[model samples]
Target: MKSIVFTFSFVVLFTQLAMAQQSNEEQNLIKLSLDKWQWMADKDVEKLSQLFDEKSKFVHMSGTWKKGEELDIIKTGRIWYKKVTVKDTAVELFGNTAIVWNRITLDAVVREQVAVNEFTVTEVYQKNGQDWKLLALTFSSVRDTHQIKH
Candidate 1:
């Protein structure tokens, strides 16, 4: 009974360690997703769209749900992000899927009025073949501010 318990503990510890390593790898993939977000803020729609899967979904802070063709959001001009900075990020992995949570501070002019918003964002990514693509994203706006200094 004692030997069995000890073996089970070791197995659990080893499994946890292995999972942590995989999570780290997923975090690295999430770094790429962050790069894509930066490009979106810069209005590089083409590049940003490439990072997402074809059937990806987005739930905007404004309570709008978008499905497929992320480029449409850029082309329609319903939203625009000029500068975005991500902070306090956490990445978790579940096999071929990962979730990235972060606080995003954005500088933008919505409806021709310049405003700053601090938002909490979560992006889900799935491994597609050798590459990881964004599967879904959801964000909530914390506040609208007058300006963002840096």
Candidate 2:
């Protein structure tokens, strides 16, 4: 009766706490994603070069390119990532690999023309030694109503 109800409540509380708590690795990965976004907006190619794997791929609507080309684009401001408003973010970890999905509204300058777009950006990362390197980043245009289902 009362004893059983008390035990059930304790169990439920414990389970909810466990579910709400995230591991350190998961927190670090999410932070990395957020930092990457800021670095992109800042055009910080020096830090970006270190974060991006040598064979990393960047896929955009117009074309796909490797790390060097992507760095060059950022450095030269051929397409400036002026601002990114991240509406939602979700990150999942599988062993040493992590994937981050960000639903964002991006304000950018392309060939001196301003473009505002809503997109879902998928970023894949792999642990390399003590650091996590970005392996791939792909963008998919989506509507404003899109949500990240974690």
Candidate 3:
């Protein structure tokens, strides 16, 4: 009876430790996603390129493009991200993939026209070896009727 009880306790402890580790990993991914947003706002094309997967796709309200094309647009000042303020974020993990939803207020210049808007951004990241690369990013404009309290 004592051996059985000890075995059960060991299993419970092991499961708890595993869950803690997974939670830490999820938190790290959340931070990475936020940092990516900062990199975009700063126009750090090199870092952005490194984080983006080769086959990544990006969708904006105006259009959609692949990784290289999106990088080129940022590099050439065609679409400049001036600022990004994240209002709320949620992250979900499915095996080795993570999906993040961010409600943000973005200030940017598109085709030399400055615009500021609120959007709900969806970012998908996949774990590759020891690193996580962004696989997709899609932005949808938030309706003006819904106000986000600062």
For residues 10-55, could you state the per-residue lDDT of candidate 1 as single tens digits?
9999999998887679668767867877777666777766677878
Candidate ranking under TM-score, highest first, comes to 2, 3, 1
Candidate with top TM-score is 2
For model 2, residues 15-45, the per-residue Cα lDDT tens digits are: 8777666556777887888898889889999
- TM value for model 1: 0.72
Task: Say which prediction, candidate 1 or candidate 3, comes out ahead on lDDT.
Answer: 3
TM-score of each: 0.72, 0.86, 0.83
List pairs with backbone clashes in candidate 3. none
Looking at model 1, residue 48 earns an lDDT score of 67
Instruction: Tell me the deviation in Å of residue 137 in model 3.
Output: 0.3
lDDT of 3 by residue, 1-150 (tens): 999999999999999999999889878987998899788877889999989999999999889999999999888879888888888877788999998888888899999899999998889999999999999999989964444342
RMSD in angstroms, all models? 5.9, 2.6, 3.8
- Each candidate's number of clashing pairs is 0, 0, 0
User: lDDT of each model, Cα atoms only?
Assistant: 0.73, 0.92, 0.88
lDDT of 3 at 65: 95
List ranges where model 3 is wrong by over 4 Å: 1-19, 144-150
Regions of model 2 farther than 4 Å from truth: 1-22
